[model samples]
Target chain A: MNWLGLVPFAIFSLLFLLLPTFNIVLGAFRTQQGAATLDNVMNLAQPRIAIAFWVSIKLSFASALIGCLLGFILATTVALGGLPRWLRQSTLTFSGVASNFAGVPLSFAFIATLGRVGILTIVIREVFGINLYGLGFNLLSFWGLVLVYLYFQIPLMILIITPALDGLRREWREAAEILGATGFQYWRRVALPILWPPTLGTMALLFANSFGAIATAVALTGSQLSIAPIVLFNQIRGDVLQDPQLGYAIAFGMIVITGITNLIYIVMRVRSERWLK
Target chain B: MKSARLWSYLIFLTGVMYFIIPLIGMFEFSLRKRRGEYSFDAYTSVLTDAQFQQTFLYSLLMALVAIVFGILLVVPTAYWVRLRLPKMRPVVEFVTLLPLVIPPVVIAFGYIRLFNTSSVLPFLGSQFGTDVLLSCGYVVLALPYMYRAVDTGLRAIDILTLTEAAQGLGANWPAIIFRVIFPNVLVAVLSGAFLTFAIVIGEYVISALLDRPAFGPYLVWIGSNKAYEPSALAVMTFAVTWGCMALIQVVTRFSKHTRTSI
Candidate 1:
């Protein structure tokens, strides 16, 4: 076999994926004149940059956790809750569409649903005399963004974790029940252990998915929201703070975080397959 | 047992509401263009606008290019890896997944710097060149989906034996791959292509930063200025996405039926 058959793929990845990322990393540690320096990375310690990172982490963590939990419930309901075959198929198909129904149009959909003059907002006010804005639920805040992010995040969780749920053998459940264990006990003892790896892996995927998202947040919250991706977006586009090199540092940081998350996801996936072996 | 059913029903109902409400709201808001009544004025306006047609057509052309280029790059590589370089499967899969981890903004950022007019490879030297670079970036963004779909398709068929059989019959490598293998996995390639279309159609970050007149940036522009028209555009975008996904379902179903009947 000519192993050289793999050359084109390698070169494409190098030119597109690895090289651009390497440029960011290399640029992160150098001055404009090419001298090696730590100033760009150090700029991350500035309160604003540090807060941007914190806010991003907090948003990703909240959204991923909520998405994972809700998606787990939805998937378990469809896959294991004795739903009909058509329901399962329809759910899967809808999840496929909704998960990809993200970015710019998703923001518009949410705005029409929950914005100040939204249908739900108007209905609540007319029916119960309660203002949604007065309830501190602005769709542009951190909580609001989490609410929007869950629209896709939960569907994504459902799409990924459904198979894992299916991988759960009925024999295990029957065996647990024959041993006089309740349904809850079967899940806690037999099911949760087997599912831990995939569950965690899916959560990490969700985290990275939301962390690197730029368009929906930018469209909904504008560039005013100090999330990491938006901050990075402005920096890359305008060098808004007058330091082009610091932009490289921020992009480098995003790569490191996402890479680490994905690495954990890969490790968990490998570990999850151990049971099958 | 009944309680479990009830719980399941409640959860499913809640999920359906969550998924459907935004779409309903967008549709309803779009119809509110006539003030205190319902009409399709907003849709008509968005459809008739010259800029909308231009940008939508521009993005559609870009989507086609990305899908074609993505297939050209992915199919052969996936086929070769499965047929010859089995040891390189892990490496190839890892490379495919790299695009998911890296944000589009970062990729476009790198392109602006690395392919600017002054750079050795000047992809941004002209407007046409910038469109090519933007489409290339779309290919990267859609790589994860395209590669995975094509790879899964390849795995479904028996490529190794087919290649050997064709080789023994005095067929050359290109003939074996194109004539024999390509037609077999055409369904899988079509599924991936539709998905890439969905992704490239409404993408905002890369095209916005690249200053392309694409549908995504146009949607954002309308959102900032117009009220009801943005909702109309949102509904239209949703319909397009649904169409792509439904086409995927049909293709898969058709492929399965054909396989079973044979």
Candidate 2:
């Protein structure tokens, strides 16, 4: 009976999650001769791969940092005293729905609203002769990916951090105040120390989430972009790479990055749990 | 102080505006006719077309199938973990979070590699084989939220007491499990199901990978090639996601138990 309960989850996980991952890892080393080698893993050091790798890391860090700062402030404000409980809950519900609200349609939305031919683009031109593109900020390039990623990242930040903030005891803040700690002094010495761990973990999770995403990036920037997931997507879809095994190799690269990020999440979660204690 | 408050309000309101403008823009674009006046022509086209109707029906049915799969896979483990396997709760929780940590794109590829070969897996050969595999994959993608909802409901209940009472009545395994346990977790399952419905209805990654013409893939193709109709399709998807969320709100409004997770 116990095995029955475990059986369904195990089978689904194996068929859907584990096997694909297994296929990706094993496919990485198999040569064209059907023999395994180090060629695929070693491909990470190629010049173009190096550029894509650097760009992805930079964009992810910048977006995650901006998202975390904005999310932390937003969470602290409502979770403390900025909004009434009803308002706070309502805002959160909206944010929750919107945060999970990305993918193909989201890319379409951004394009139609902010793209070169977008409505706001025409309006901004007439109003200020400030062509959005003239300003050299292409919403269809590297910055565009960041913009779309931020669409969800900030809300995710708010969602994950708000509940943790709800656990912050007001009495502690009051005690710090009574001890003659000024506002800045109190936050720096008290709140920052208490809040750093969860804030950091949420930041890491958001980075990983954005890092492994493909649809939004692909739809917005075109699949030819060198992002690892986009490359893998193209591979599997019969694009540049003809072999599905090569696609699996690309997928393996993505999994390694995500796996590393998730391991970081685990470590952060444990440290956050202890720090909260 | 007042000016600072105004500044903060401005920032937050700007964020809200940016978020909503695209949804409104899609609908606005969908409504405008060739005469440059608002009309229902786009929607009428979408509605009257046999392919559109078929795709929408397929999507709705697929959503339900995935939701049912979610309940079947997640409900059992969530119950047993909360009741008999208390020690394994953390491990169970960790497994549920796996889909989120590994992005959807990677997982979608994983499915193709694992199940694409007919010779390897006996079931990947036919249409039925692929669709069933797709639903199973959808369940995995939606697992974190669905399982969490059920687990939260379990935390709110005295599951041990419920199971023990059923056992004392000499109810067998299935009877005690279904009759006593499932009743309390029904709302959690419903909430999870609705979420799964939204995800599967709009999901493009897995469906496209599997080469199925599901709703998400339909929307993607329409959006990319045909500009005007894509806006109409976006409006429809927007309505569907919003409707699902609103439906859940209405259901929770009437019920005594409301579980909120962000």
Candidate 3:
């Protein structure tokens, strides 16, 4: 009787979530006439698809690395830096909002700030006499995308890692201080050992977050950038690659990469929870 | 101590600047429609556009449907898992988190292929069916947050005691779930609902691929077509997202206060 209660939820998931994903995974393995083949997955290694994956990986890595470092500093400042309570509260509230503020609107905001004739660009040109376009800064480039992604990426990192930072017991730091340890030594030996797991886990999450992101990329640079999501988006829109199976292969590859990163995050989170507990 | 504090404040200030400058630029650019002086022409144009109004309302309706559906699906499962199916917690959790692992584009792509006209179910055969499919997709995208929120809420309240007490009063399963557990976790459900609204309102991949007239695709369309209007839409979108988050905070704080008072 109790098990019967899960029937509706189970059926909903099976029909909507699990089945669609299963269909994609299954299609990635099958051919046009439904014969099993490895050709689609093999085509993932082709130059264009491979380059898209490479660029996506690089962007995800760069943004995640920078987001983690900057987010850690900001979170640490609030959690341990003796900042006023109101600042910490506002920072957290802002992060909660900013982390969710992605997709097309975020890209538009970035373009407004950094694009040609943008406010900051014009200000820089007028005040400093250095033209951003003349300086070879384009908001549609790879680094430009990374800078835009950082808007949400950093906030997500802060939201995820702040609790872990708060979990750093004051007793441990005081004990380290009393035992002839400098502040630097305390962090290096004690805090770093405990914090590394969550930090790395958050980096993995951020990596997956940006890797799976398509809205900002598509809305910002259009087809000018051939990141994996944009390539996938184009493929979905008009079958630019002329092979639907290859599209499935792209989606499959994304799942594999993000799946691995999220797995790492789950494992690291579990390990860190053990210590924090 | 002073130096450390100074360094912390400096880092905080830098982070704030990084986050705030884009918003300031977006607002400033949104006001640049008239060229010679700042004005609200961009915002007025976007706000008055029929497509904008239609798409925003469409997305708003879709968000409401998704939230109601998500609550129905998640709250019950989370409640049952806590009360009876404790052994299935890990499986339930993994299923909930699968959305985070699978990208929205992939999910939308899969929906296109799996539910096409030729498929057995054929959810994409008609506009109504596609709308249903899109709403379900939104629910899937939001499953992680909704499940976590409801699960956290369930954890906070004593599910076992509540169920037993309701049963002792001769309450049926549906009544117990709706009357007993649902009221208890309303705050969590509201938080999840606001987050869902935030996500669904600005969603791009699913609605775009499904050919829905949601605000996300509209924003992207305007962005590609115009300049100042995109910034205006961005500012408005940011306000909506901020409002959602702020409402979640307000709801949570109000619930905490009420609970304490009780």
Q: Write the per-residue lDDT of candidate 3 for residues A136-225, one digit (tens) a residue.
A: 999998899999999999889888888888888989989998999998999999999999999999999999999999899889976568
> What is the per-residue lDDT of model 2 for residues B21-41, given as tens digits with 9 covering 90 to 100?
777766666676456678888
Worst ten-residue run, lDDT, model 2 chain A? A241-250
Ordering by DockQ: 3, 1, 2
Of candidates 3 and 2, the better by DockQ: 3
Most accurate candidate by lDDT: 3
TM-score of each model, paired residue for residue: 0.97, 0.93, 0.98
Rank by lDDT, descending?
3, 1, 2
Model 1 agreement with the true structure over B184-234: per-residue lDDT tens digits: 888888989999999999999989888899998898888888999999998
Best by TM-score: 3
Please, what are the lDDT tens digits per residue for candidate 3 over residues B1-262? Answer: 8998999889889888899999999999999999799999998999899999999999999999999999999998999888888999999999999999999989999899889999898999999999999999999999999999988888888888988999999999899999999998899889999999999999999999999999998988899999899999999989999999999888888889435111
Docking class of 3: high
lDDT of each structure?
Answer: 0.89, 0.75, 0.91
Arrange candidates by TM-score, descending: 3, 1, 2
| Model 1 RMSD vs true structure | 1.7
Q: Which residues of candidate 3, in runs, are more than 4 Å off?
A: B257-262
- Candidate 1 lDDT score at position A235: 86
Off by over 4 Å in 2: A1-4, A32-36, A243-245, A275-277, B1-4, B257-262
Lowest summed lDDT across 10 adjacent residues in model 1 chain A is found at A1-10
